[model samples]
Target: MATCEPLYWRRCRSPIGWFEVGEPALIGPDAILYAMKKVQLIRDKLKTSQSRKKSYADVRRRELDFLVDDWVFLKVSPVKGVMRFGNKGNINPRYLGLYKILKRFGKVAYELELPVELAAVRPVFHISLLKKCVGDPASIVPLESVVVKDSQSYKDVPVEIQLV
Candidate 1:
């Protein structure tokens, strides 16, 4: 005499091994429910593994590309080059207003549609210093307007202030 261990679906990696399904009289509601839960557990595990792979792929992948005429916000660096923060880090802006991409200079550098006031600064900026912006233009808070001077020290000017 020999015993047989039934195999489930070919793709399933579940620990559960087989039972006879033809004996409907012996199959109770609890058994069906248990089978369903097991399948669902496997589904969840597969989904998690897929999600992990996607995230890992994203980690090594490049960021979003910017095309000409696309709108994006410029990232601000509080300290760089001979620029001085002068212990005024509290009021430094994390990012600047929206700028349109003018040209894809090289692989990562881009020319932006900068304001006339920022004429001194180079129009071309690296991709790392830019971020995509998707928001209403009217809602942006102009906390401190950047006053760039002579390609050296820049200033952040606030329009209003109140002690709280």
Candidate 2:
């Protein structure tokens, strides 16, 4: 009987009885201040990480500046077989148009004079989507001479052969 009474007293000191476990829950102004400080720390860390990522991205990025009336090619799609902005499939050309820039919309965007076929698409495009046209003759490929297969492979055949 004596041992049982002492054990019951010890049990009452635990959470199984009325007593709370661990540290008491913080309340009032001190608790609010601690929470706010934690939130501020998290925000600071997030900002630092985001800025670091942006710096890495900016290193590879080339600043493209286009003036009004400059000729440029617009990227049709970034990936093969993915439909984007009216262009689709690997058969389609990666870029379209030696379109002329009609106006400059801030530093990162330009308004191009699009053809009637592309009237449905927005003329304004980001600088990343536009490639400056140097008008290199070698860069131009004759469509008639090239044949693309469904597997996205092409075989080059000579149109004519001559020995000088």
Candidate 3:
């Protein structure tokens, strides 16, 4: 009966013969050297492909650095069938608030001084989850002023009713 062996072993010139009893000396050091050369070639090819992939990724990568006390907007992801920050819909804002950076955790993590309404969320977030907030800082509104319910919803109270 013929036995099945891997194609790589066959390429490596390793003895895989049926019916013939081959001695150890039959497979000389040359065959072993050939196998080692094949392995080295595979490793070199793998390294070349990996470097190519990394170069492609580096092209799209952006360096983000934020100082302490800098204001940044937190990127919000709206999950299906989940309500966040009082709303979840097509019109929901993609980014939320001017959160102040409390501290930097390494190069890619930061601790933000989040509002009271966001106490449920972890203050420390990845740099990718944040965007630098530009323009006037006074535009930020205090979360305490907004009456957000436990269900992340708020009632729209009419401050004035003007009859037209």
The most accurate candidate by lDDT is 3
Candidate 1: residue 81 lDDT (0-100): 67
Instruction: Please estimate how well model 3 matches the true structure, expressed as its whole-model Cα lDDT.
Output: 0.76
The global C-alpha lDDT for each of the candidates, from Candidate 1 onward, is 0.70, 0.72, 0.76
Measured over all alpha carbons after superposition, the RMSD of each candidate to the real structure, in angstroms, is 14.2, 15.6, 10.3
Better candidate by TM-score, 2 or 3: 3
* Evaluation by TM-score, superior candidate among 1 and 2: 2
Give lDDT: candidate 2, residue 148: 84
lDDT of 3 by residue, 1-164 (tens): 11112323433333333123454445556776775676577667777987999999999889999999999999988786654765745577788888899999989999999888888888999999999988657755567889988999998755543465
Clashes of 2: 0
lDDT of 2 by residue, 62-112 (tens): 977889988998987667566565444535677886888999977898999
Best TM-score among the predictions, by candidate number: 3
| TM-score: model 2 vs. ground truth | 0.55
- Higher-lDDT candidate of 1 and 2: 2
lDDT of 1 by residue, 7-44 (tens): 34343332343444454446566877897786667667
The true-structure Cα RMSD of candidate 3 reads: 10.3
| C-alpha positional error of residue 29 in candidate 2 after TM-score superposition, expressed in Å | 7.2
Which order, best to worst by TM-score? Answer: 3, 2, 1
